[model samples]
Structure formats: structure tokens, C-alpha cells
Target: MSATHALRSRLRALALTAGLIAAGAAAAQTGSGYFRYGDARLSLAHAIAVIEEPSDQADERRTLVFLSAQPLDAAAVAAAFDAMDAVREQAPAGGYVRLCIAADGSECGLFYSPEGFNSGGYGDLALQRNEAARIAGRWQLAEGDFLGTPYDFDLRFDTPIAPAPGSALPAGGGAPGAAYNAWLEALAKGDVAALRRMGGEDARGRFPEDDAGTVKESLKSLRDGEPLQARIARGRQHGDQAVLWVEGVDRDDIRRRGRVLMRRTAAGWQHAESDLSSVDE
Candidate 1:
């Protein structure tokens, strides 16, 4: 071959070798990541990050579901658990899982981290067919990639509310029920007078009439790609004070959302600041 032709061929060969080396590195990065629970490995497909978040209380904040590059299968799920186990064998943290199956567990779910299960979740995400509460599992991880695992290994959820559309009131929420009703009426009819009456006793009162009316009008139009369709989920009483949670239902994900706090007042329940936060593990 001529010198020019030989030089071109050598350059092409060099480029090919470089491309192969790059491809190998990409593959290593793809499979290099994994979190372990005991001996179980959890491949880092995607994660539901909730580092310092309280597991209870459903809200409308979107739960971030980490999507695996590949569709999650039973085998991949098992691999992911293996990764989780690898981490757990260390720091020796405590974690739990909630699995559901048919009448017979012919089909069963791989044990999932509570963070994974509850991340970005509003209300309860029922994993059991009978709507059973959580089933605790134990695993320990070192300085691995996980948030604080539960300690007691106790299932704190009594009725474990899922993020579907329904009114799952807690044992005692009547204290705030009146206030919630007032809100419903005010919103339904765009009643600014009721808003003024229920406003907080501060300089700004609670919600101004104009603001309330504007809010109602906006909510009436919330169906167009709205993140939350506010609804009363449940509440608890603290003597004269009570806290009612309004679920911000995610119309898109169909599985994630956050919570907003509504506290009982002399007139009724007054809207309060939202506790919106998240984590990673």
C-alpha cells in the first residue's frame, strides 16, 4: 500500500481500539453499582430517596421512583436485594419489607426497603391483598448507600393507607372535621365569607376573601396537568389542638404525592405551612 493509504489504515485501527476501550468502561459503570442487604444485592436502577423523612403521614409531594434502565423483573429485584444485603452486612442497620401476594403467595414481591416502599408515597401503598399492614424485615448496612433503617422492626401502621382515592380517616379527626367541611363548602360554592370567618386570628387573618376566591377558582381549573387534587385523608387530635392532613394526590404517577398540614382552630381548622421534604438511601 502507498504511505498515505497505510497511514489512514493505521489511524482507523487506532480509533477502533479506543472505541472498544470506551465501550468496556461504559459497561463497567453500568454494572459497577449495587447496594446490598445482607447477601442480597440491589442493583442501582433507580431509587426512592427518603434520607431523613418521616415514613408516616401521606402527602402529595411526588415520590421519586428510580427507574431501572431495564424493566424491573423478579431476577433483577433479587439482584437488587443482594446488593442491599451487601450493604446490610456492614453498619448492620435494620430495615423492613411489605410484600403482597395472591390468596396463595404463588406470586410474591421481593422484600423492599421501607424507604423504597414509602418514598414519594402519599397515604399508604397497600402491598397486601387483604390490605395488611407492614411486615418487618431486618438487615444491616455499613456506610453503604441507604438512609436510617428502622430500629424496632415493628410495623407501626395500623390501617396503612394507600395512595388511591378514598377517605381513610384515622381513629379521631372529628375535631377538624367541621373545619374541613367549611373548607369544602367554601371551595364548592366559592364562598369568600366563610373563608374570612375561618381565617387565622393574625393581621392577615387566615386566608383573605379575595385570596380564597382566587384559590377556589384556580382549583376548579386544577385538572389540567395538576400535581395535586387536594382531599382530606385523615387527622389526629392533640387536646384542643388537632392536625388534619390534606393529601396532595398526584394525578400523573398514580402512586406518589405529599401532605399539607391543617390545624384545628377556634373557628375550625386553619391552613398551615406544608412540611415538604425528602431524602436519599
Candidate 2:
């Protein structure tokens, strides 16, 4: 073949390869990737935006690709996140938020970053991701080590998270919210009776066994192990229900956050489980 003809053939091949690459890039931006699970039709990118925006300040840094089982229900999931966000903003303080929605439309994995980390701290990226996944209802996934230290986690969810039906509790200095703050203070002082009295009956409904033994044990672990140092990021209220963010430290001493759902009963506001409800401290 003539030299000129050979050069032309090579140019054509290069063009074809470039086009293939561009197509792949576009697919990735649309949430195509390995380990994609959940609602097959949901737009992972959109859901990710809903969870990551407040924390990242609206600039999306990466893509989330999940093979979904539900149709692209980005609208509903995003709405849920928005409702939750509105309630969180009502809190006395604010913090960073991250979330992930499953494709089936029944679950979401999430977490928050509390105040104080902006100054300086270790970047516990793996724990942050794992915790968020667990919060979003990915309990079935096996626990395994993340980063170097021993750990266990999975982001696979087959069930739905409790609806984050926006806050419904009364604002400051009322029964439950104020009472909850008192519980925190009392807990710090190891005043178990004060904690019990402050906790409402309905609060027991959602908590494990709704008894002092369970809660006291959990609180004790926090007091001794991680030493909960959290900023009251925010609180939300809607009717008798509420949510709280106690931005605490992660395993690596980084400022990660946890949340609790408040359930109000006849006596006063009670505490329930939230994504961060399982946190040790």
C-alpha cells in the first residue's frame, strides 16, 4: 500500500477509537458502572446529587452507579431527601449530609459530617462511606475491613428505611426537644434516673426494647469508648415526630455525624431510630 494510504487508514482507526471512548464517558456520567445494584431504572446521579449537594456545597465530585430494581424514581427519592433536608435546616445548628438511595425505592443509605472538621482532622473516607451505606438500609451486605483497621460494612439493601417524614415536633424549650437535651446533659453526668424520667413512653416504642437497660448500655459505651463529642447540627419537627443530628467523631477521630428520630407520645417527645441511630457514640 502507498505510504499516504496507510496514514489515512491509521487516522480513521484513531477517530473510531475516540468516538468509542466518548460514548463510554457519557455512559459513566449517566450512572453506569460496576457493582450497580438496586432500582435499575433510577438515575443514580440524581439521587447522589440529592444526598451529596449540601455536604459538597452543590458541586458534584463523582458518579454513583447502582444496578436498580425499581424504575427511575429519582423524583420521589429526591423529594424525600428534600423533605428531610428542610427539617434538618430547622435545627438550631447545621452540618454536612450525605445519602444514597437504592433502586427499589424502599431504601436509602446516608450519614452526616458534624461541625469542627473544617479546621483540621483525619480523612476517614472509608468509614464515612460505610456508615452512610449502613444508614441507608444496606444491612444485608457483609461487614468487612475498610481502609486498614478492622471494620465491617455493606451497602446492599433489600428493605426500605423508615420514611424520613419531615420533622413534626415543637420547637425549642418544649417537652421532648428540651427534655432530650436534658437527657444528653444527664447522660454526660451518668444520671440514669434523670435519663429515664426524661425519656417518654412512646420513645420506648421505637428504641430497642424501649427500656433503660438497653439505652443505658448504649450510652455507657458512648461515654467510655468514643467519648461522644458532637455538635448539635440540626433538629426538625412535624406534628409529633422529629429528627436530631449529633455530629460525633468517627472511628478514626474524624468528625462524622449521627442522627436520631424523635417520637412524641402523650407524655412528651420520645426517641426513635434514625440512620445514625446505630452509631456507638
Candidate 3:
């Protein structure tokens, strides 16, 4: 062969080899699963894992989410957990499967959609391969009827774990203890005015002007039949944002723990998000 022709043939071979390598790399990063709820069927195309830190109320957990329509990057996965409502509202025509795994490798939660299937009667979940960077598993649930609808689920995934998001900002600044304490006190006293003042925009919106009495009753019922005596145990703050971990016991002898996300404003720290759950001894 001529030197020029030989060179051209070599270049074509190299290009084909490069394309095959790229396709293989893409395949390695992807995973597959599917489920059917009632008559709706969906296929999952991507898998990602997110690590959740231990809260004052709950243990550390890892969540594996399978996406149906679109692939997600690490930041997008983090954002999905942070703002799930927004993600759901903007989600495309496909559904998702979420599996929460505890630190000890047990399945803690399973959820899927197309109407929801949160009722947990999981039959089998086998994690044949579990590693730091990769997980392969199969999940199965027998056919059953729920709330008048018939459904069944089965899923399998084999994918690399997307890198965990960076650690949270270091705990600093004065814990927003005062605001949290005041909010709790107001809740106990049924003081609508104080509660409104300490609540952030999202929290304040929950209190409707036309339903003051209902709001008071709702707040009163939040404490159950006993009063809560919670206090902030620790906190982390960065700029205008902060999170406080609270620990305490109720009058009924049940331990209550929670975490509150706070945002600073002209009126001092206000509650933006709060989650409190009881832990039984």
C-alpha cells in the first residue's frame, strides 16, 4: 500500500477504536430497573446513591434512587433530596424508585410512584454485591392489592455510586437556640402572634388568617397529650443559614429529638424547616 493510503487507513481504525471505548465507558456508568403500578409501567435508566448524615432523631442512612427518564449528576442528586417537591413537579413523563438502606445494610424504606406505593410489605431484597463504589441488587414484592388498586414491584440495579456530595459546613456561630426555644414556648402557650413572628416564610404561610382557631388547635395537637421540653443540643451555622439539633423528653417519658433549619432575617433567626420525631426507649 502507498504510505499516504496506509496512514489514512490507520487513522480510520483508531477512530473506530475510540468510539467503541467511549460507548463502553458510558455503559459502565449506567444501570437499569423497572416496575409496574396498576396499569402504569415505567423503566429506570440511571442509578445514584446519596449519603445522609445522622440526625438527632435518626440514624445515618444511604438512599439509592433510580431515575426513569434522565440521568443525574452528583449535584442534581443532592438537589433532588434537598428540594424533592420541586423535582417532582418538574419531573418528566417517567417515574422513580427509591430504596433507603440503613448503615447496617438493611432496607429501611422503599417507595415508588404512578400513584404511590409507600405501604411497606417488601418480600425480598437481595444485595448480592455491595461495595463502596458499586452496588448490585434485586428487589421483589409479590402481587397485592392496596387501597383498592392492584400492584406489584420488582427492580434490579448494578451501577457505580456517584460521588457523595461534600460535607456540610462546619458548625459555628451562636446556635439559634433562642429562636427555637421561643418557638417551642409559643407552641406550648398557643401564642399565635409569637409563632408567626418566629416562623420563616414557609412556616408562616401554614398559618392562614381565616383559620386562627384551627391553627391554634393544630399547634396544640402537635404536642400530643403531653408537653414537650426540648432544647438545642448542637448546631451548625454558615452565613445566613443554620441547623440546630434538639434533644429532650416529653412529659409522657418519650424522648423527642429534632433538627431545625433556620434562616437569619431582620427579625433574627426564624425556622425554615423542622422535623421532630419521638424515640421510644
Candidate 4:
């Protein structure tokens, strides 16, 4: 064959290969490696985003990648991330937020960050993601993690949390909210009788005479120093139970500590589980 002819044939082959490669790239970006678990789908980029960790190399910085269950454009993902960024802006600085869309319309995921060294602090990511999945309604996603791994949480909408009405008794106070406020006030004042009274029958049973010594010791220790000066930041109610989300300045000068008191049908607005316990002190 002529040398010129041979050169022309090589050029043609190169062009064809280049076209194929371009098409493959587009396909991969669209939906090449998205993982599907029933109606829920996680994209390859998103999976990588969630599992990615900090690297020794300085240039190994992490970036947010928003993936949809179905095909989405860069613009669509960017818009979602923008909304998440807004939420992040509203959140206190030095924290992480996880963004993921759950099967339900409600948002699901983690939104917390430790003080330093990738600490796993408030709003435990794993637990939040699991709980978000359980609730009904669609869940929107959010970003929530530093180094973003060790917990691959997805974003979900904030479920309206309210306190159960008539649940808390008026012990030297008014309504449930008022009583809770009074309880905290009494607790701050070291008013044991008032605190005990607010405890109602259930709290009393839990703090009976047999266990009074230990209970008193514990309660006294907690009530000793200005009662932590807590304020109700928010409240959420679910049937007979409710959660009084509080922010308190601890004696240790931790500034504001996120605390939660779970109130159930225990004769009054009695203390239940505490979310603060989930964090590292």
C-alpha cells in the first residue's frame, strides 16, 4: 500500500476510537455506576463522597457531590447542594451536615461535627440516618460529616417536633411548658421538693425512698451549681411523649450544650432520655 494511504487509514482509526471514548465518558457520567437498593439509589460519585476519608496528602481535600436516584444534570445537583449549603450556613460553624434523599419526602441524614480531630459529637450520624429512614413522608438529603466517612448519613427534612399537651403537671407552676420552665428554675435554685413534686408518681417511683440516697446524691450534684442555666431552644411533641430541646451553659464553660429531655406520661412533664448523653463531654 502507498505510504500516504497507510497514514490516512491510521488517522481514520484514531478518529473512530476517540468518538467511542467520548461516548463512554458521557454514559459513565449519566448513570454508569449507581447502586440500587430497592427504590433507593446511591450514585458512584455519592458512594465515594460518603465513604471518602482524609488523606495524608495535603491536596486530598474533600468536595460535596449531590447525586439523585435518577439521572440529574450538574445544574440540578448544584441547586440541591445550594439548598444544603443554606442549611449549613444556618447551622453553627465548625460542624458537618450530611445530605441524602430518603424514600419518604422527609429529609434524612446527619448534621453534626466534633470540636477537633474529626470528633463524633452530637446528632450521632448513624442513629440519625436510621431514625430518619423510619419516619413516614419523603426525606430530603443533606451533608453531615467531616472527612465524611465513618458515617455516610443522608439529608432529611426536619420533622416538626412539639411537646405533648397536658403531659406535665403544674407543680408550683402553670402549664406543661410553664411547669417545665419552673422545674428548671427550681432545679437551678436547688429546690428539691419542687423538682420531686414535678417528677410526679413515675419519677417518684423511680426515685423511691430505697433509692433516695443515691438519687439525692446524683440530683444534688447535678443541681448544685446554678443548674446549668438551660433554656428551651426548641420543642417537639409526638403523642403522649415530647422532647424539650434545650441549650445550656455548663459550669465547665462549654458555652452552649445541646440537651434534650424526653417527656412521657409520668404524671407530669417528667424527665426522660437525654440527647446530651450521646455526645462526648
After TM-score superposition, the amount by which residue 66's alpha carbon in candidate 2 deviates from its true location, in angstroms, is 7.6
Ranking by lDDT: 3, 2, 4, 1
For residues 33-134, write the lDDT of model 3, one tens digit per residue. 567777887777766665544454345546564555566554455433253443356564676767766666778777775566675546587886677676
Over 4 Å off, model 1: 1-172, 202-232, 248-257, 274-281
Among these predicted structures, which one has the highest TM-score?
3
lDDT of 1: 0.37
Q: Which regions of candidate 3 fall more than 4 Å away from where they truly are? A: 1-29, 57-62, 72-87, 119-123, 128-134, 141-154, 158-173, 189-191, 202-215, 222-241, 251-253
Please give the lDDT score at residue 201 for candidate 3.
Answer: 80
Residue-by-residue lDDT tens digits, candidate 1, 103-130:
3222232344534533221122332222
All-Cα superposition RMSD per candidate: 20.1, 16.8, 5.5, 19.0
* Candidate 4 residue 41 C-alpha distance from true site, Å: 20
Over 1-281, each residue of candidate 2 has an lDDT whose tens digit, in order, gives 99999999999999999999997654331222112122111222211223322221123212121222222333233334344444344331223223343333323343432321111122212221223222222222232333333322232322222233354434442454565566656657766566555555632332354476777676665444332444555566666666655555534565544555566777566544434323334
Clashes of 4: 38
For model 1, the run of ten residues with the poorest summed lDDT: 152-161
Better of 1 and 2 by lDDT: 2
Q: In candidate 1, residue 35 scores what lDDT? A: 37
Go through the candidates in order and give each one's C-alpha lDDT. Answer: 0.37, 0.40, 0.65, 0.40
Model 3 gets an lDDT of 0.65
